[model samples]
Target: MNSPQLAIVLGTRPEIVKLAPIIRECRDRDVPHIVVHTGQHYSPQLTEVFFDELELPPPDHALGVGSATHGEQTGSMIAGIEEVLLEADPETVLVQGDTNTTLAATIAASKLDAELGHVEAGLRSDDRGMPEEVNRIICDHTADRLFAPTPAAAENLRAEGVPSDRISVTGNTVVDALQRHRGLAADRTAVLDDLGVEPGEYGLLTLHRAENVDDPDRFADLLTGVGRVAREYEMDVVYPAHPRARKKLEDLRVPNAVEVVEPLDYLEFLRLESDASVILTDSGGVQEEACVLGVPCVTLRENTERPETIAAGANRLGGVTPTGIFETAREMVGTDAEWENPFGDGDAAARILDAAAATDADGADDSAAATEAVQ
Candidate 1:
């Protein structure tokens, strides 16, 4: 007869951004919910700023599981999360995307009797080389409910032998977060003025992928290509430099054409995103957000799990090579603005929560029945 409690787990910036909507929804509904931060991204600038900007509650638990090798980090998270699961004993555990936190929490909660829900489930590049692909596949198998962001994702899950009953084609929750924050961003319009750039007159750049930023040649080529694009279009580029990319740019002596700026908080980033002419990045969440905001995106990766954005004409995959980057930028700049957003409208978070609550209630009823039968 009691309302079931929900536990939402997030670790990285993208997970925090995408999960904000569902957290807000839980607050509005007065659902008994606990938020656990894994501290996977330990920087104050990255984690604290996002929580403050999003007005998210301070996490109920911070695992303080800072950076490590992939295996070590995930193993540590599983240990930490198991402790949290035992202490919280929530009716459901919610995780977002294909991070170590998502996979570890999925495994932890699945091992327990609690219901597990995976947001952004069923995305696949079909290339097992990427650790994220492995994380996603493992989480999908472990989850009790799959909250897929698109029909394509749902179909993928079905093909992979996930029962249709456990899979629900809810739209992507990133759109909900984007729409909610874009309104706040409009009200606080000083970011553009502070950057001294007119709206829609600048290109946004973000590159932090290991492939692009870790290799010296690739890093140099990316910087050169980005600088070339800026010069060719006569557009100012505002790069909220990722810490790793910042070091690489300095080491490689990147051109002065690209302005390296400190990372913006979520609202500031959203405002900048709203006003940018185009976004060039390897970030998965940015790909979805750009599509939702109707901004043309040139993905810096060779491939993406969110292929619906490309199929819908909202984005194009541009590899890290100089020629590939330049060609894609030119193509996007020349493309028409009539592209459709394959990602859903701003209702995804609501839909996901609805399904979760229903699933939780049904689970509780079944458990009660089993107990009575035992008696």
Candidate 2:
């Protein structure tokens, strides 16, 4: 019924999870905001369930721009998001993480009158081979507001010559969302029981990145590596297969110790993450979640955007080889899980809103609005 003052654009499960706190903040503040889902991740299990689990309002707009080539997906989402921006005519448009949806929303909002804010800004893996890295760089350069999750991220923005005025170290919303929902996840989900796994006994594995799964040789080596870790540690691993990765599983000799399961909902996955002995993943969000959850993590990549996890001693880069994965898993499994969280306290959502509200619709400073916004 109200003309939305903010437009939150997202498209993947990680986006939904990371942005949930902001949506809740908006509701609590009575800030009229509309959610636009670009359908980059369209599966109901991955997408719709998050809205329900997070108690978020259904998306105001869903652009069914399903699977396509990188260019096609980004192009389609830009057109769809532009249409939503035109109609909603919000004062600010916010997008989270590095995805086609983020890039599209950034490009769309850049051309419009709305100020564009990028959540999880200035994360660089320094791997130009990854499409996500490209998207992150483009979105950061184009955004009016850069919400860096950590001081390191803020420094990266500064090094890139991003104006200090346009940047804010608002922490990572994943911490906010995780702190709020992990208790609910523990209480509401019996995923551990359903999977016949006990707390701190089973390993959690997730591999969806194109670099890891798209190559047959690399995928096979990763599975073999997990198998080595499982056998060495005497633990069974639950691999919640992403749709893209699942397709490549056919005819591949999956390790007997690694049980491939369908993708779990947010609550289920969170429960698993909270209780697992070690988490092996390529997802940046999972890296943050693992760090926040105090779970030892072994990244299945050579480099990561979330290097804070590594510097915190909560995570180790395992690369994509059997020897590397096994060694990292062995090293991480012995960790105490007491590493300090490098992300931030669970108030990022509030700070981000504060920053956004501090600026007027025309992008001018308004100290009174900032104070009122936090009040």
Candidate 3:
């Protein structure tokens, strides 16, 4: 049996959804790649549910390294990912986004002679306080090949002193995933019907980021504000609660006007998101998807790594303040979604594969060297 040349490492639902196009591209080209599940999400519903919906193959390796402190989680991932890399010895390991799994897998692969490719590289909110910002900075530095989502992102790498030769402007893969699965979502998903809402008649809400949900007062403010907007606008607000956020519920029925639901799989969620009149979310991916789908998005974060979304007028920043959230949602409900998408033309996966292959063709892995130079 020959060892695969590429290993795609992923954990959590967002990573799976974002990486689906790359995984499918590998299959389409008959490329030798292994899928390794890091189990950073811990729940089957949040991990495997996506693979099932996307028709992805089961992972070649599964590391059930569940939740832990940042250090513990990342450390656990490094040990487990090291075991897999040692056995597989792929020429390159591809990780997406800025989850602990991505950082851990990239670092562990670095310890070996394996090269690293980051799918969503050079994204920065510039806030070191955000764990994801830290993860992306490290991953971008360590990656031998950096697939940036936009020109702005590539410029960020250049600003950080990453070599121009290694960075490829691959559009956000979420657009690819949306294009591929949205029809399936619309055709198959009954979530809108199940929720008793008409297309463009309601707002979709997804708030799970630690910054928003961690503080009791802030979280309460967000919900209260959203509820006020929902009531005033006479629109239903459907929230698919993240498991972590669900656990911190001070009042299940708080703002009883809003409907909190179990998280939907990717397809169903996409269906809901696409036709939504307005979108309120803290997830960066959601912001990109809303932009691509021409839905007005009110990001509930002070800053976003995906600034192109806001610059294009498809999105607006609505901080954690109740007033900010309510006013942004109210004003943004009238926002036009016809702006040109700055992410890409939905060919990011192909460009990523081409860049990655070209990178490895040069023979020597430059990951460690690049990291050293950047640092």
lDDT of 2 by residue, 1-375 (tens): 656989999999999999999999999999999999999998898899999999998999999899999999999999999998998899999999999999999999999999898989999999998999999999999988888888788789889998877877777899899889889999999899898999999999999988888999999999999999999989999999988899999969999999999999999999999999999998898999999899999999999999999999999999999999998888999689778888877888988888887654422242223222322
Residue pairs clashing in model 3 are none
Which residue pairs in candidate 1 have backbone atoms (N, alpha carbon, C) closer than 3 angstroms, thus clashing?
A: none
TM-score of 3: 0.94
Best by TM-score: 2
RMSD of 2: 3.3
- Please write out the lDDT profile of model 3 over residues 222-298, one tens digit for every residue: 88888888988888889999888988885444586678889888888889998999999999989999999999999
lDDT (CA) per prediction = 0.84, 0.89, 0.86
Better candidate by TM-score, 2 or 3 = 2
C-alpha lDDT of residue 324 in model 2: 97
Estimate the lDDT of model 3: 0.86
List residue ranges in candidate 3 displaced over 4 A: 359-375
Which RMSD values do the candidates have, in order? 6.0, 3.3, 4.4
